[model samples]
Target chain A: EDKVVQSPLSLVVHEGDTVTLNCSYEVTNFRSLLWYKQEKKAPTFLFMLTSSGIEKKSGRLSSILDKKELFSILNITATQTGDSAVYLCAVGKSNTGKLIFGQGTTLQVKP
Target chain B: DVKVTQSSRYLVKRTGEKVFLECVQDMDHENMFWYRQDPGLGLRLIYFSYDVKMKEKGDIPEGYSVSREKKERFSLILESASTNQTSMYLCASSPTVSEQYFGPGTRLTVT
Candidate 1:
């Protein structure tokens, strides 16, 4: 079975602090890795990383995939209270639209 | 923008009752999926359909069934609502092997 694990299940940081959340996975025919942010309702897409070493960024959030290491990391720079949410990492397999998601890292940013 | 819509935001049902959760996507995607989200479980796929009338079991398919009568709509049915089935249900759709668009989840509570 494909599995994705995330590190530091929960983190607390003050505003302007930087946080890095980790996700590692084991799957066959790996395709892409996706990041999402969930506050109260549904999760919103953050970034999608396909190639190793190449980083995908959006404002204060950036993510990179290390295929060789079978892991990915999501970085939030200059965090704000609005960034407090559950950050989820999901892996998609080749030729299938199915996604295996990590347990998610809960980030709490205090002002 | 792609839009995924769920029928309800919150639902409460008695044990043994038959419950149905509806989901619809407006992007005319060929693949639709149903997932349940829990505190520590992230997202567990219940079932998915690649085409109309085509269904496949996912990682956690027990106690859940799905229907894809139309290309744009997928419905998840719980044969008998149980306390263990209480969770936030999410629906997603994708065109191919791309990132999925998710609906605002439906929170179900079984009493």
Candidate 2:
């Protein structure tokens, strides 16, 4: 049974604050991990990590995966009200292209 | 840019009625997926298609059916709409077994 769990189900932060969202997974033949941010209508892709230790970053968002530990973390720096959304983490299977997703972390950035 | 589109953004259906959700991708991706999003359950895979006319059941496929008549279109059908089936349905497509591009999503309400 593949399972993905995320910590800090909800968080409240102020402008310029930094936040870290954690994701842990237990799956067979783990191939990749992905992050997404959902505002209102849809979720936008953030980062995809396959290798352990190496980090992927965008303008103010970054993520890293640790295959050995079976976990991944997404960090958002200089948070703004625009960053308020539900962050989702998902793990993909190598052979089937199937994905198992976590419950997600809801972050509300205050002005 | 990969553009995944859903047939509806919001839909309301009565109990025991049949419902259909359509998805299309312009990128001609090899794989397409259907998932349901809930408040605390995250996104649960309902079904997926690797190619035209080839469908596979995901973690939860009960009471749902899928169709992939064309390479770029995938449809999810509910045999009988129930109140418990009300959710946000997401459609995604991928070129390979990697990062998937998602559609804006359809919010379905069953009364």
Candidate with best DockQ: 1
lDDT of 2 by residue, A1-111 (tens): 789999989999999999999999999989899999999967888989999999999999999999999999999999999999999999988887777899999999999
Give a tens-digit lDDT track for model 2, residues B1-111: 889999999999999999999999999799999999999889999999999999999988998999999999999999999999999999999998888889999999999
User: In terms of docking quality, how is candidate 2 classified?
Assistant: medium
DockQ of 1: 0.88
**Candidate 1 residue-wise lDDT, A5-65, digit = tens:** 9988999999999999999999899999999999998888888899999989888888999
**Could you give the interface RMSD of candidate 1 in angstroms?**
0.6
lDDT of 1 at B14: 100
TM-score of 2: 0.98
Residue B99 in candidate 2 has what lDDT?
A: 81
Clashing pairs in 1: none
